[model samples]
Target: MAEAARLLAQLIAIPSPSGAEGEILAFLEGWLRARGFPVAAFPVPGHPWPNLVVNPQPRPRLLIDVHVDTVPPQGGAGPVGPVERDGMLYGLGSADAKGGLVAVLLAVEALGAGQLADSPITLALTVDEENRGRGAEALARGCRPEMVVAVEPTGLTIGVAEAGTLELALEVRGRAAHGSVVEGGRNAIREALGLLRDLEALPVMRAEHPRIGQGAVTPLFIQGGERALVIPERCLLHLDLRWLPGIPRDRFLQEIAGVLARYPVAWEIVDLSAPFETPEEAPLVQAMARALETVGLPAIQSGMPSWTDAEPFARFGAQAVVFGPGDLSLAHTPAEHIALAEILQAARVFQHLLEAFARP
Candidate 1:
């Protein structure tokens, strides 16, 4: 636990912004090497940062994956340096992932090489999980584990499912006219807002699920009004939509199409990450539940509110779940931090989970 605290502080001290995770990755590989752990450094195609995949197995029954990148640090949000005070460690990337990442490392160290040699396991420290998820995608293409644990901040609960995210880009066109003209053709921004309101009001957008909850649609970006004295001819709007599992894709599309038919708008849908759910009855989930109980923690089932590396692994038919320490809401915020006790406790949980999988 003391070692975990020390290593987590050291990791937080490092600046590992997305797309520039080389230094952190190097440090981690060296740390593992020093412990007699054989690590495989694989270069991610078309990316500067490379992934460190260790203990590769042929269709391994279990794979533990974590991302090395954190969101770029923001000024005046919180302490960029590590601060351990009153049982909490506050710093950049503390709760969001570095805490969980350190916990995984300690658990693996506890398991050691001897026991892992007989187990079908692969541990991947991937990159770009915050952005494109290309790191996870690359790892999935070659080595598809039957079950995967994509480590993220889930407050140590078993995350059974996650919502799928979609990027909706819209362009509303209108005739340009003088800003002060009484006969102004149309204001693209005004039209875009009305269209957005109607789009957000669709019943499909309100689809709900028990674990992950109701679907959501929010406007993320907008650009319009170029000339100072002219009514804009075009307005661009981007919407972020997160939908839960069981929401019929065809129904959602049909509803949107019906709405679009009444507007002068051009739109496109970019699928970001697919929603995934691991049934509680699955062996993988049962094993994790047993681990929690073994570790003296409640076997609570929950859902991941954000996208993660699990989505990519699930594409290859891997039963995936997100579980770790820290409050996800604190991530990328001024209050970002994690409880020191949770760090050690999560390590124990991971150790138990690994041992459960390693058992013959």
Candidate 2:
């Protein structure tokens, strides 16, 4: 446990923002090689750092997905110094995922080479999770495992499902006229305000999942009116979405078009991500639940609101879930910190999970 904490501290001290994770990548490669794990680094065409694959086993029993890159520090030197206070480890990436990363390493180390050989577990450390998730997309394209667990800050809950994301940039067009005689020209900015409220009431959004709940539609930005004295001809509305899983692409777009049919707006899909939910009876969830119960923790199942690497694997029929220590709300914040005990407990949980799969 003490060693795990120490490793997390070291990881937090390094600044590995999205595309510039070179130094940390080098450090991890050497560290894994020294520990007897043969590391395979795959070069991504435009990426400065390659995805590091530890244990390189194909279609293993357990595939651990971890992201090494973090969002840039919000302020003050970028979490360069580590502070331990009140049983919590304080650092930028401490909660986002460096803690989970260290815990996975500790669990594998304790499992020993003999057990790993029998279980055939693989660990893939990806990059660019905070930006575009290109690292995960690339990894998912080349690899397929029976089950993959994304070690994120889940506060130890077994995340069984996750909502997908769809970002839309709509151009709500209107006629231009003098601001004084605005009654003749349509006010697109005013119309956009109405769409914001109407979007939440869409028919597709009425259906709610037990864990993921009803989807969310939030307006990210609204811009209209280039000049002060004239009615704006165009208004741009950027929308952020969190919709339920299993909705087909064509149907999803059709539903959006249903709402915009009345308006003179032209919109396009700006960004999109797939969603997935694992059945409760799946072996992966069962194994995790049994392991958590063995460790005297609740085997609770829930849904993640944010997108994860698991989304990419869903297309390949991989059963994936998000699980780890620390509250996700603290992720990407300047005050990110996680309890030291959670790290130790999470490592123990992971060890039990590995043991369960390693068994016949």
Candidate 3:
């Protein structure tokens, strides 16, 4: 537990926000290598950032996914320095994932060579999960593990499902005309407002999942005017849509197209990530439930409120679940901190899981 906390503090002290994970990746590579673990660094194609895979033995039964990058520090603070007080560890990335990463590292270390020889485990400490998730995407493209446990701040519960993300841009076009003669000109901004209202009435927005509840549609950005004196001829609306697991991408796209067909606006999908879900009866999920019970914790199951790297792995035929310590609400906040006790407890749970899954 002390060692895990120490490593967690070290990781939090180093700022590894989204695109700038080089330093932390270098530190982890050296640290893992020095500890006698085989480390492989896969550079993210064109980017300087690299995804570090540790102890990637062939055809491993399980792969542990941990992302090193965190969201940029907000709330007027530049970067967080590690501080421990009242049995809590405070800093950026502390609750978000550094604590979970430390627990995974300690769990692997506890398994040792003898258990690992029997189990054959792989740990993928990837980069850019907070932004694009390109690191996990790359790893999934090359390797197919039997099962994956994506370590994220889940308050020590198991995430059986996660919502997918879709980003769309709606371009509303209108005829430009002088502000004095408004009768002849169609105002794109006004048209955009009407479209937005229609979107709110779409039945797809109410699509429900038992765990995560209804999906959401939110207008994130809108721009229409270039000058104050002229009627705007163009308007752009960016919409963020969250969908439930098992919803087909094409079906959702068709629904959006149906809505847009009623208007004279151009539309395009900017980004899409499929939703993920692992069956409760799967071997990995059953083993994790037992592990949590063995560690004196409830075998609770829930849905991840947001998208995670688990989606990519699940899409590529690997059964994946999200499990870790700390409250996700604390993540990316000025008061980001995790209970030291939860970190230790999570380590114990992970160790139990490793042993349970290793048994043939």
Candidate 4:
């Protein structure tokens, strides 16, 4: 428990905000190597955000994956310098993901110490789950896991499905005119508002998934117009679409096209991630449930509304489950923290699974 707490604290102290996870990657590499695990670093493009691959021998029967990168720290929490209080560890990435990563490593260490090294378990820690899922995407394009368990903060629940993400960049173009002749020119802001109205009227959003339930869309940001003296010529609106499994990317794009055509506007999908789900009764999910139950934690299958890297695995047809410590609510908040008890619980649960699968 101490080791896990220490490791998590050190990791959070490193400031691995998304797009800048190199330092944390190196830290994890050295930490795992010191424990006799072989570490390999996968090169990430455009930034030092490398992914750490920790492999121990005996052929991995289970693959544990976690994201090392976190959402950019809002100014509220200056730096996640570890703080321990009331048996909880508080920091920036504490709940969001660093804690989960710590639990995986600790579990692997425990299994190794018990001479259960024969169990097939590989820890693939990725970068960029907060912004773009490039790290997870890279893994999907490269290796295949027999059973994938994404160790995100699930409060120790067995996660079966996750909502996917789509980022829309809508641009409204209008004829710019001097402020004195504002009435003579079309205002892009007005055009953009019309487009938003159309989007708000979309009934395509289903309220629930078969297992996950209810998808949502939110207009995250908007920007346009340099000065009040002139009629704005352009406005850009960014929409975040949280979709369920049944919605196809093409269909979503079609709907966007249909909405934009009614106005003098152009739009493009700046980023897209498809919704993914695995059946609750899937073999991989069953294995995870069994593992959790063996560790004395009653396992109940659940779903998350937020997006995770697990979607990419589902897209590639890998039966994946999200399981780990920490609460989803604490992920990026100023009060971000993970209960020490949960960390210990998660480590033991993972160790139990390793022992169970090591035999056969």
Candidate 5:
């Protein structure tokens, strides 16, 4: 518990925003090196920062992945206050990720302290996951793991699958005119509103997978218009759609087109992140379940609501699951925080898993 708390405090004190994670990586590399772990920093092209990759001695690597960079702090945001209330740690990045990062580190430290059998665990702490998955993508190109345990905030649940992600930018264009001559111009705001109405009415079919379960869609972000008096020339609306596995990217795009066809508005699918599903009964899942049991925690399973590096790992034919402590709901919020107890529990869980799975 003390180790987990110390590591979490060290991680949160460092400011490692999505595009800037060099200092944090350097700290982690140094920390691991002092403990006799071989560490390498994989550089990302066009970005000054690089991902930290640590490998302890032994064969048959198990990659424990966690993102180091956080969503950029808003202006006026200051250092996180470390408050211990009822055994929980209240601070920025305490729950979303830095907690998971500490958990993995402490778990490894525990193994070394106890002289337990160590299987090679590659700790890939990458950057830019909040904005994009470039770090995960870049690392995937070089390192392959027998199994990947993506340390996401899953409240300690074994997350076997995550729904797919699609980024939609709905644009509406109209002639700008004086407010007094309202009828003389086509209002882009009105067109955008109409498009939104149509989108709300569009039927997104439900999806089912053997392990990932059903899929649903939700509207997340919207932006449009500039002036109150003038008819705006343009508006943009963005939506995030979660699709189930086996749903082709083209099919998802087609559905978006079908929705926008109801209105005379310009729309495009700007980006798409493929969804992933791994069988709950797979060997990797069973191993994780057994490990959780050994730590006296129930082996609960659930589906992830957002995207992660798990999708890219699935592309490489590795059974990946999102499992860690903290409530994901706390991610990126001003009041974001996590319990120290949860961090300690996660460390124990990982320790049990790594030791038990060392042979395989």
Candidate 6:
């Protein structure tokens, strides 16, 4: 537990914001190499940042997936080394995933040499999860794992499903004219606002999953007009759409198209990730439940409202679930932190799960 805290602190000290994960990746690679763990590093195509696979055994029975990158710091605050206070470890990535990463490393280290050799467990430390999930996509294309445990800050609960993600860019065009000539041109920004409002009220927003709840559409960013003096010729709006498992991607797209057709706007999907769900009866899920029970934690099952690497792993034919310590609500916030007790408990549960899965 102490070693895990030390490792968590060291990791939190490094700044690995989305596109700048090179330094942290290098540090992780060196850490694995120093411990004699067989490590494979794959650079994201066209990017210098690398995703690392440790103990890359063929047809591994279990794969532990965790991202190394974090959302850029908020309020101009950067990665300050972890600080211990009120029984918690506070830092930029502490609760989000670094805590889970530490627990995984400790659990793997706890396994006996013979067990590690026979179990064929692999750890995928991915980059770009906060952005496009490129690293996970690359791993899914390159390796095959029978089952995957995607580590996230789930407050020690097991996440059986996760919401899908869709990003759309909407461009509304109108004739540009002098601002003083109100009747001569349409304001593209004004035209886009109505469409945005309709999109926000789409029926899909009411669609619900038992655990994950209803889907949502958010207008994340918008831009228009070259200058305040001129009417805008074009208005660009970015939409972030999150959906549940049973919702078909085409249906979502068609619905969006239907709304866009109501107005004069051109739109394109910038990115999309499918939702993923694993049966509660899956062997990996059951094992994780028992491990949690063994560690004196409740075997709670729920859905992850946010998009995760689990989606890509599932698409690659691996049954995957999200599990780890810390609270999801605390992630990506200024007060981000993880309980020390949760970290210790999570390490124990992971160790137990690995040992049980390794048993013939």
Provide backbone clash counts, one per model. 0, 0, 0, 7, 0, 0
Against the true structure, whose TM-score is highest?
1
What is the per-residue lDDT of model 6 for residues 262-359, given as tens digits with 9 covering 90 to 100? 88788888988889889989998898999999978899999999888888779988889999999999899888899888888988999998898778
Error of 2 at 107 (Å): 0.8
The regions of model 2 sitting more than 4 angstroms off are: 75-81, 246-249
Tens digits of per-residue lDDT, candidate 5, 128-171, equal: 78777888887776776768888989999999878777777777
Q: Give the whole-model CA lDDT for all candidates, comma-separated.
A: 0.86, 0.84, 0.85, 0.78, 0.76, 0.86
**Clash pairs detected, candidate 1:** none
Error of 2 at 207 (Å): 2.6
Give residue 287's lDDT in candidate 3 (0 to 100). 84
Q: What is the C-alpha RMSD of each candidate to the true structure, in Å?
A: 1.7, 2.3, 2.4, 2.7, 3.1, 2.1
Model 5 residue pairs with clashes: none
Give the higher-TM-score candidate: 1 or 4: 1
TM-score of 6: 0.92
Range of the 10 consecutive residues with the lowest summed lDDT in candidate 6: 76-85
lDDT per residue for candidate 1 within 1-360, as digits (tens), equals 578779999999989988989899989989999988898877788889789988876589999999889988887856986999888999989987999999999999999987887888889999998777889989888788999998888889999898888788889998899889837678888899888788778887776788877778788899998757888889998988776777666776678789878888898986556688999898889988998889899988888867898988887899998899999999998779999899998999999989988888
Off by over 4 Å in 5: 56-61, 75-79, 113-120, 177-184, 205-221, 226-228
Span of 10 residues, lowest total lDDT, candidate 2:
73-82
- Model 3 misses residue 259 by how many Å? 1.5
Query: Which one wins on lDDT?
Result: 1
Candidate 1: segments with Cα more than 4 A from true spot: none
Better of 3 and 5 by lDDT: 3
By lDDT, rank the candidates, best first.
1, 6, 3, 2, 4, 5
* Model 3, backbone clash pairs (residues 3+ apart or across chains), number: 0
lDDT of 1: 0.86
